[model samples]
Target: MYQQNGEEIFVIDGHVHLWDATEENIDHRGGEEFIQCFYDYHTTFTPEDRQWDLDEYRKYGPDRMVDDLFATAAADMAIFQPTYLTDFYTEGFNTTEQNAELAAEYPERFVLNGTFDPRDGDEGLEYLDELHDKYDIPGVKLYTAEWRGDSKGWRLDDEEAFEFLEKCLELGIENIHAHKGPTIRPLNRDAFDVGDIDDAASSFPELNFIVEHVGLPRLDDFCWIGTQESNVYGGLAVAAPFAQNRPGKFSEILSELLWWLGEDRVLFGSDYAIWNPDWLVEEVLEAELTQEHRAEYGVEWDVETKKKVMGENIADLYDIDIEAKRETFRNDDISQEFGLEDHYASGDPAPADD
Candidate 1:
């Protein structure tokens, strides 16, 4: 929980992962390149003192992840958005099974979403079923840009992709999170295209489409599509770190999102390990829209909007009762471990200083 103007803001990091890029896990040269690329991004945005060395970045494991996210009470909850690049890693980069290690132990602290690859055909459908049956996943994190054999990737609007979408509808999986961020190594740039989302979102109005990274470098395309589809949303992961070092760009990006998609459609995320929420949350919460941006965009990054972006909007999607969770957290295992019982004792504002 984040305290601002004496008000407690329950934060739900909307995008996160528990991945392995260890040398032992690397199968192809692409695996090495991939983690390096991610490290570049990490160092680019992260503060010098807070940055982790490349060796630690490859595989931070689950225990350290738990401490980083919760010990300081930076984020109230987080979602596990898996990225399975099996073609690169021997086992997998970050599979549903791998993430479940921590999610299962602290079910109340995390929402684990599964993934699907349309290229697998019938077996892919079966795998999706298996994930849903075993985990009862309420959502899926898709990596359309992931590689498999000779094929580079698939599109969200592909017929095979639609088949998987239909199955999701059948199984009552409603949240569809797609990675439309910057291109990573071994993945085709065209594969991360945001155009497919326009058709997919229209075709499945029953499901909610959360475009991760807000299709950076393609923000306009995504914003146009977002305007047409009522259920389309923006997940701020790669963009959120900008508040730390690129405040101007962050203001512009967030202003455009607010102008085009409105406050209810934008969600905050730290993309953990890549950027720790402990400090990232404070930077973002404290950031302000520039005077020029506020004037031109006619939008305010106010406390109310911050509340929605930080947690309320996502809570609405995941059906999380913030108040109820606060009550439960007063004595939950995590609270006991972190000594945060006083943080959730009541929702009242802190007393004014004398």
Candidate 2:
């Protein structure tokens, strides 16, 4: 929790990953490249002092993640969105099981989101059912660009994909987080297109579709779709850092999202270890769209809007009672350990270059 201008903000990092990208997990060059790519993203946007070394970035694990997000970063809750790249890593990159382990250990702090591949058909559906029963996840993250045997990727509008979505509705998992951001090597760019979300959102009006990274390079298309579909939302994972590195671009993005989807549909996400939530959360709270920019986009960035983006919106999505949860968090062990008497004064230590 962070206090700004006498108002407390309950932050919920809407997108994060707990992954194993160590040298031992690499099955091929793609595995190494994938993590390196994430490292590049980290270095590109991260402040010089906050950056981590390659080794530390590879396996920061749960302790550091928990400390960074909850104890230090002022995040009241975090949602784990897994990205399983089995073809690239021998043990798969960030499986639901790994995320669930963290959620199980710290049940109050994390929300575990499972994943499913449409290509797996009925078997995958059964696996999803088992995951729901075991973990009782409220959402699922879809990486359309994940590489399978020979197939490059699949779309949300695919027949098999629709079947899984229907199952999600039946199982009471209404939140669908889709990765429609930048593409990596071996995964076709077209595979990451946001077009499929249009059809899927239209078909499954009962479910909510959050396009992670806000469809990034394809923001225009995403904004258009979001304007038309009431259930579609924008997840600011990779894009949130721009509030520091490129405030102008961040302003533009926020304006577009507000103009199209409104404040209720835009959620804050740190994307975690790729970029820590502490700085991103602070930056977002302080940043604002200029009057000129707001006039141009016909949208305003007010305190209430920022509050919703920071936590309330996501809390509503996951059925979290913000006030009730905040009360519990204030008395939690992590909060006490961090000596959060002064919420504005972050107790987190600086990252050590290992």
Candidate 3:
């Protein structure tokens, strides 16, 4: 929880990952290119003093991750969204199993989500079942553009993809987080297109389709779809950092989202490893909308809106109780390890007098 103007804002970072892009993990050239691409994004937005060298960026391990997110108490909780690029990495890039190692250690501080590719067929369905049985994942991070065999990508509305969606519903996985944003290395630009989301979101009313990165470069299209599909949501991973170096763009993008999806549907994310929540959270919380943008979009970046976007909305989606979490964090292993028991204690309710 972050104290802004004496108000306790429980921050739940909606997107995060523990990935390995070391040379040894590279099974193909694309693996190398992918990490390089990620590095470029990191350097572009991150503060110079905060940026990590290519070596540390490739793999930071679990201890560093714990300290980065919880040590400073920048984020109260975080959700791990796996990106499995098995073809690129020898052991696969940021698979559910990899993230589970961290989540298992600090279960109260993390929400571990699984992943699936429709191309895997029956084996994929079984794996989904296995993930549910093992971790009871409430969501799945999807890479529609991930290359598999000769096929460049798959569409969410495809028949095979529908089978996976149905299986998700059957297994009680309701949150469908799709990577719909700027093109990344080894990922086809056309594959990240937002058109397919329209049908998928419409067809699956019971499920929540969270379009990560808010379909940047295609924000207008995404906003249009979001307007029509009430179940659709936007995750601000790539866009949130704009508050640091691109304040105007952040204001514009956030205004567009609020105008289209309203405050309740926009979720905050640092896209950790790509960007850390520690500083990024501060930048976002302090950012204000320009007068022109406010007049043009009729949206306010007020405290109430900030509370919802920063954590409350995603908390609602994940069924996390903020007050309850605060109580647990008061003495949890992470708090004791980081000496942050006092931090969580600050959010505790006052005693009732006789």
Per-candidate TM equals 0.97, 0.94, 0.97
Clashes of 1: 0
The alpha-carbon RMSD values of the candidates against the true structure, listed in the order shown, are 3.1, 5.4, 2.6
Put down candidate 2 lDDT per residue, 241-316, tens digits, no spaces.
9998899988988988898899899999999988888777998888889878988988877777878899889988
Tens digit of per-residue lDDT, candidate 1, span 83-178 = 999999999999999999899999999999999999999999999999999999999999877878987778899999999999999999999999
Q: Report the candidate with higher lDDT, 2 versus 3.
A: 3
**Which pairs of residues clash in candidate 1, taking residues 3 or more apart in a chain or in different chains?**
none
In terms of lDDT, model 3 sits at: 0.91
Q: Tens digit of lDDT per residue, candidate 3, span 1-354? A: 777787777899999999999999999998999999999999999999999999999999999999999999999999999999888999998999999999999999999999889999999999999999999999999998888878788889999999999999998999999999865543434865899999999989999999999998789999999999999999999999999999999999999999999999999999999999989999999999999999999999998888899988998888887778889999999999999999888644523111
- Write down the worst ten-residue block by lDDT for model 2: 345-354
Q: Residue 57 lDDT in model 2?
A: 95
